[model samples]
Target: MAEILTLTALGDNYIYLIVGAGDAVVVDPGDAGPVLLALKGNGLRLVAALVTHHHGDHTAGLAQLKAATGCRIYGPDSRCISPLDHLVRDGDLIDLPVGFVRVIATPGHTRTSVCYFLPQTEGGPPSQPAANARCTRPCPADVRPTTGPALFTGDTLFTAGCGRLFECDAAAMHRSLAKIAALPDETLIYPGHDYAVEDYMFTLSIDPHNQAAQQALRHLRDAQAQGRPIVPTPLAMEKRTNLFLRTDDPPLAAALGIRTDDPATVLAAVRRRKDAFQPS
Candidate 1:
C-alpha cells in the first residue's frame, strides 16, 4: 500500500501526500511551501495533484506547484482554475503511482466538489497470523490500522461535522453525504479540515446522551492537547458518532424537536441548529 502523509497548511487545512515509488500525488494543496519542502526533504518527485473543488484555499497552490514540478492537475470540470489538465466525473478512475483512485462526485460543499476513493489492496503476506490462529489477538483501541481503503473528502465531510452549505441546499448536501455513507465501514475518511473540537462539541449539544460522541469528544480533546492530528476517521465510527450521518436515526430527529422522519428535513433542522450554535 502507498504511504499517506498529512501536512498541515493554512492553519486547519490538510494537504495529503500519497507517496509511492519515490513519486507523490498531492491532494488539496492549499499552500505550496510545505508541499515543496516535503518533496525536497523526502527526495520525491511530484507526479500529480487532485483537487476536490475550486475554492481558493484548496487550489491556490496549484499554479505554483505545477510550475515547480510540471505536474498534472486532475479535478472537477471547471473553467475558473487554469492548471487543470484532466476533468474528472463520478465513477472516473485515475491511475497513480500508488494505485487507481476512483472519483466520487459529492456536490454540496461546492457545485464541483468531488472525493477520491483509494481501495485497499493486500500488500503481500500478512506479517502476523490470521484470526483463527492460536496466537491471534485484537489490536488496542488507540491503535488504528492504516492499511485500508481511504476516502479524500475535501471540506465536504469533517471528523464529526459536514461543511456549511455554500453553493448547495441541505437536501443536496444530504444526498452527497449519503453517497459517502454507503462506502465500506473500514474506509478511512481523510477530510480537508481540522474541526474535531468544535464539531464534537456541537454534536454533544444535540445528542448529549450519546456515549460514543462523549467518548469521542474526550479523545479529540486529548489528541488536540498533545498536538496530534484527529483525522482519517473511519466510516464506521462516523456512522456511530457523527450527527450529520445519523440524521436518519429517529432519536436524532427527536433531539432536534423535529416531528418529521424524513432524513433531509432532520438534517436541515440539525444543520440550522449547528450554524447558530456557540461552542462552549
Candidate 2:
C-alpha cells in the first residue's frame, strides 16, 4: 500500500506527500497553507520534509510547516534553511520501510538539486483506457510498467516539459536529466508542478504529430472533464515523449543537430528552443 499525495501550491507548484514505510515525508513544500490543509484532509502525519533545492518556492513553507507539524527538515546544506535538522548529499541513502530510499544527487537544475528514487512498486498507471469505448486503446505493457518507483522531480521534470535552467547551464541540466531518463521506463514521476496544460502544448509545438503525447492529452482531457488531475506520469511515457529526457532519442537528437549520445549539446539546443517557444 504505497500512497503518494499531491497538494496544490502557489500557481504551478506542488507539495508532495509520501507515506514511506513507517514514516511520512513531504518533498518540496512550496507553501505552507496548502500543505497544512492537505495534511488535515488526509489524516496523515508529516514526519520530515525533503527539500530538493533552496528556491523560496520550494522552501518558503518550511518555517511555517515546522511550526505546524513539528517535522524535521532535511535538505542540501548549500540551500540550508535555519534549524536544519539533517543534511544529506550525493550517494546518501535514507532508510524507509518502503525500501532504502536512495538520494540521487542530481544537480544542474540547481546546485543542490536532488531526486528521490524509491524502488517500490508503482501501484499502476492510472487506468487510461477502460470501459470508455472511445479510450480503450491499450497502452504497451512492456513500455509502461505498472510497478516501480516515484521520482520526486522538483521543478526539474514536468509532465511533458522540463524545468527552466535558472542556476545551472543547459549542459548540466541535460546531464542531470539524462541520469533520471536512464531509470526504468515504468517508474512513475511526481514532479513539483502541475504544468500538464502547457506541457502538452509544447509537445505539439516540437513534435506536432507525436502520437504518444496526443494520446496522453486525450487521456488528460477525459480526466479533467471528470474533475481529476492527470499526474504521476509514467517514466516510460516521459522517455518516449519529453524532449528533455528524450534528447537521447535518435530522431530527436537529429532534429537538434546533436548526436544522440551527446546529452550536453542536445540539451543546449533544446533549452534554446524552449526559450524561444510559445505554446500555441
Candidate 3:
C-alpha cells in the first residue's frame, strides 16, 4: 500500500509525505506548523524529509521538523538552505525500508533543484512482497500496487503553470521542464501549489484560442469546487496543454514572433510574454 499525504503550506506550497508498508517519508516541509498538524492529525510518524530546493518557502521549517521529529533530510549538497543529513546528487538512489526513490538532478528552478521519483512496490524485476496489503486479502489488479512512479515536483511545475525563472535563465528552465515532460504518462505529478485555476486564466490570455487551456480551466474549476488536488498531471497531459512545455511549437513561436525553433529561444519568448501579462 502506497499513500502520499499532502499538507498545505505557505499559501500554495504542498508538503508531501509518501507513506506505506510501515514506513513514511516527507517530501519538502516548507514549515513545521502545518507538518506537525498533519503528522498529529493523520497519526503518521515522519521517517525522512526530501528537499527539492533551498528556497525558504521550501525549507524554512526544516530545522524545526527535525527538532520535533528527528527525520533525516535528503537534498542537494550545493545548498538545501537547511542542514542536510544526506546529501544526494543525480542518478543516486536512496534506500528506504519499503522501496527506493531515485534523485534526478533538475536544475533551473534553482541551481540545486532535484526531483525524486518513487518506484512502486510491485512488479519491477521482483516485487517487494507487501508485508500487509490494504485493499484486500489478496490485492486485485485495479487495486494492485501501481507499478510506475510518483513525482514530487516542487516549484518547477504547478497545475497548469510552471515556476517563474527567478535565478535560472529561460533556456535552463525550458531544459529542466523538458526532462520532466519526458516521464511516463502514468507518473503522478504532484506539484507545490493550489494556484492552477488563476494561472490557467493568465495562460489562456496568451493563447486565447487554445482549446487545451479551456479544458484545463474547466477541470481546474471543477476540482476547486469539489476541493480536489489539481496536480500530478501526466507527462502526456502536460505535452497536450501546458504552454511552457510546448515552447518550441510554431504557434507559440508565432505568438511571440520568434522564428527560431530552438527550445531555449521559444522559452525566451514565452517567458517574456508572461512576464509582461498584467491583469486588466
Question: In every candidate, how many clashes are there?
Answer: 0, 2, 1
**Worst lDDT window (10 residues) for model 1?**
134-143
Q: Write the per-residue lDDT of candidate 2 for residues 83-185, one digit (tens) a residue.
A: 4688878778877544566777777767778888777663555555222222123311111222557788887788987878878887778778878888887
1 against 3, candidate with superior TM-score: 1
Return the clash pairs for model 1, or none. none
Local lDDT at 154 for model 1: 95
Q: For model 3, how big is the CA root-mean-square deviation?
A: 5.7
TM-score of 3: 0.85
lDDT per model vs. reference:
0.83, 0.73, 0.72
lDDT (C-alpha) at residue 25 in model 3: 82
> Which lDDT value does model 2 have at 136?
23
TM-score of every prediction relative to native: 0.91, 0.85, 0.85
Q: List the residue pairs that clash in candidate 3.
A: 189-232
Candidate order (lDDT): 1, 2, 3
Model 3, 1-280: lDDT tens digits are: 4666556777787877776764668788887887776666556687888888888888888899899888898888545366689988888899875468888877777877888888664433113323223333321111223345678888787766777787788878888888888776667677877767766777787788778778888976876686554555555666766778888788878877768888888877776776777755
Best by TM-score: 1
In order, what is each prediction's RMSD in angstroms? 6.1, 6.2, 5.7
| TM-score for predicted model 2 compared with the true structure | 0.85
